[model samples]
Target: MKPYIFSILFLLITSISVAQTKEVLLKKSFKVDENTILNLDLDNANVHIIESKDDKIHFDYQIIFYNYSRRKINDLLDDTSINTSKNQNQIFLKVKNSLYLGIDIKYKPNFDYKNFNNPINDVYKEYLKKYYKTYRKSENLYKTKDSLIEEINFSIGRDMDNYIKKEIDNFPLKKPLKTDKKIEKNFIIEVPKYVQLKIKALESDIKCDYDILTEFKMDSFKGIFKFKRIDGKNNQITSSNGILETYGIKNSRIQLRDMYKVNIGSISNSKLKLEKTKTKIGEIRKNVSINDSNSKLYLYNFGKNFTKFNLTGDYSEINLYNVKDTNFSMDISGYNTALNMNGTKTSFGASKEKELTKILQKKKKENSPFLGNIEVLLKNGIINIK
Candidate 1:
């Protein structure tokens, strides 16, 4: 993998501007091999990739430009960018955040209103006291054209309630007057420990305690991988609201595409493919296969190459707890769906068991050999795996 392009530099040229707090220092040094294949694509900012025994590949950056301006810091020293590509053991980087501000400030709301359907005040005092009591009982009637139409409805209802109480007493509740424009970039990368990281982020925040990778591709948009530990054995993570706190990758083969709920903690000897994701889960250590119409997945631990769990979703849901005598194999079908499994040497197969929803298995002591060949294909939704 080779591709590097960066025109617009910083790091010892010591002649900067931006009319305010300004500083830039981006040290670089690279000389690969020993399993080097680093790739990073960043956005917003806050990343730190560590692991160095001095094998090479160091980058110490420090950029600050608050409220920039000076022709946008000289058009970021003239058209900013940092894109790269390298091969024969790969190394590609792309960074962007060219401290800008050439001149742009457009705000709205010059204030002007006339009662947008009773702008508060108990909705104009309960509909103006029943509309002036039905206009004084329909002008009671005093001849002379009903007393000149009740003096023109009491002078247009007291001048439309004083122009709606002067537009609710001049609306404009503070704030807003902020000429926005700010930029800041902070990163410290030092590679060479166990190389193999393919990360892509947007509104960034990443930290990796590298362990010499083999393969890891993470695509996060609204990023956050705090205190991450990499152990790539063909690991793939595709995220939106990114936040993966890896404990220490091992026994791998995990492919996850998450959007909503599924905050895993530990995984081992993995084998998973979670797509269109969100397994209403908090944590699961392995063994999974899911496909969703929307999203929902959760298989409470069975670590060490977790015993099989295959799920297919529609309007999904599967919540089960550590059943007593756990011997797994549940092939569920879907409709109005619901699978609520409990415990006690749970055995089933033969169609419908109803001992008042069985729950009488108590002398138990055995912890997860992790077996559950549970196969569920849902359309509507319910599979009580007990």
Candidate 2:
């Protein structure tokens, strides 16, 4: 057989051997009160956590596998395990061991059956009928099936219609395959509104929303976290090579470090610690204190009644925008820094000046007596206030 024909045969055989399947690995619930804490450790999974009115904590862990044989799936099921234990008011859930399943490849052949059923085929059939109507007693040109196929090919080759010609030209003669692959594990966890979460995860995504939890803490390595409208007193998140995003935070303390990207929105009375991260804040309300290092921070806007803003960082880029409407006083102290306020640029520590300190005040109201105070101490960086 030809090499291409052999390749097609092998692909069809392989495709026929494997099938897509899903299996529930674990389904369990824990009885807890308002003060319960959930300590979870997982890898290679997506966790969706939401608040529930019920006092019990419910979680479902499952696996979705593709292009794998039943035997292989059974082997994987035997090898995977999740460990759980209860410790006082805290429930511990951890992944003991799991084998890495090979990536799944979804193959699609280039040949489309619907394209072969074109209107041109119907026209050719009509022509065949009309031609045979007149030559019924005479020697027919399409005497055998092979001769009919040849006539169809000839007609398609000689067609002048652009649509038909383009279709024929674009259609692949060889049944080449297109492939895509994805591997996913998912967990849906539901807990009480007042419960706390302590999670340590790797290469996983987590999403939570709309709960007045006591605390939300996670130490993740290489993953994405998204929190929407979550209210808490002490919510701390730390990640390395990860993305952290929050839509709303209220009266919370958040510590984030070593993140690739960070986006925080509409926070009030919060304490934030950032290190080696690229951060963006949508709005600051009330008061906020930030301590950062070797990062870039961008503040988009401020709330009307915000009274305090303090930032301390080194080797960073700090940008504050749209603060001209607020009455505030800024005390900046840093060395080897570039300060740009209202397009006025100043450099520090590059000349004879050492440990320079500059004070700036913006008063949009009469007799406001500095409604806000902005303090910044940074080294070897750029600060922009406008």
Candidate 3:
């Protein structure tokens, strides 16, 4: 037998002897007033928030792990230590080490939560504190804010890699060559109808099936987010490297970076900033502004109340359908951009002028002026209006 195959078989036999699966469930609830807000921060978990009729907040945390020792399971439970508190109409629920430096913390199987020289949990906490401190003081720095955040993210990645490798070397003989390990977490939060939500997550899927309250705020990195109805007055979302799908957004301010896919069912009175994203909108109501860079945008339909639209993009593609039926006056300014209005192709920047401007009018009723106004500024892109 080959040496590699023999080693694999040996490891499998060893795993079969000690492999075990376990599940943990934790539930908590708290009462609140009419003006309460739920502030949540977590990482690496599937989180679902449902609207409740009662005047309270309910949290259900579930965890499952396969092929993990009892000691490791205990560590995981400790790492997931949820902190819940209430202060003056504000409720806070924080997951201490939700991801704990990524799932399946296989390194240092016998990790000691009480005493350890280089435990990942401790290192993570310390570095996170430093990172936030740096962020708070970034306004005074010469470097841009985004650059500073990127630098800190890179630093954390490098430091964690080094620490994990160093810890793995300590148990070289006892560490299994191949361990079938998996950890899954599902968290559900039930809140009252009047409560608002503020969430910050990392690599976690966030879903809300019902209508939200008066406010909603989200900041996430690399996750999938879906909300059925966002009936709120103040809403803000900041996400990157993720997928977002939402519907019925009354008002919102959204910033997307490098998103894989985004879909908005119906949105009105909103501001959007996009970077390297692919986005589709079902219908657009009135008073919306969009700034895009290196993105692909699709607008399928327009609402009858759409009164104002302002769009600016560079190196982007925008397609608007069913424009002939809408009552709007469009002012298009393009530089090095292609325009295909009802299959009549036109190129800007071909003439001696730096830019080209065109006006289009579509009246819903005869002798009646356009009900809405649209302004577009684009460069190095394509605009399709049909």
Clashes of each: 27, 0, 0
lDDT of each: 0.51, 0.66, 0.71
Better of 1 and 2 by TM-score: 2
On lDDT, the candidate that comes out on top is: 3
lDDT of 3 by residue, 1-386 (tens): 69999999766755452354545455889997778889988777677788876887899977666666655676667766677888888999877554652443434343335556645445446545664565446422233223432332222122343244444455434343244365655677898878888999888777786778578899999877778778788799999998787766778999999998776777789999999988777777888889999998877666766888888999988887656665666677778888888669878775556655553444455565555777888878788886
lDDT of 1 by residue, 1-386 (tens): 12222223332233443334555545677788767778888765566778776877787766555555555565674544556667777777777654342211112112223434433434445445765666446422222323332332222113334333334334342222233344455568888766777888876667665553567777876655643344557677676654444534455554555543234444444555555555433233445565655555444434333555566666554454454444444445444444455432333232344222222223322454544455666654444343
Question: Model 1 off-target regions past 4 Å?
Answer: 1-21, 36-60, 68-178, 186-194, 198-213, 217-232, 236-252, 255-270, 273-288, 291-309, 312-386
Prediction 2 global C-alpha lDDT = 0.66
What clash pairs does model 2 have?
Answer: none
Native-to-model Cα distance after best TM-score fit, residue 367 in candidate 2, in Å? 6.7
TM-score of 1: 0.31
Superposing all C-alpha atoms, what RMSD in Å does each candidate have to the true structure?
22.8, 19.6, 15.2
Badly placed stretches (over 4 Å) of model 2 are 1-19, 71-79, 96-178, 341-345, 359-364, 367-371
CA lDDT for candidate 3: 0.71
What is candidate 2's lDDT per residue for 207-243, written digit by digit as tens? 7755544777778887777766557766766677877
Error of 2 at 347 (Å): 2.3
Using all chains and alpha carbons, the TM-scores for the candidates as numbered come to 0.31, 0.70, 0.70
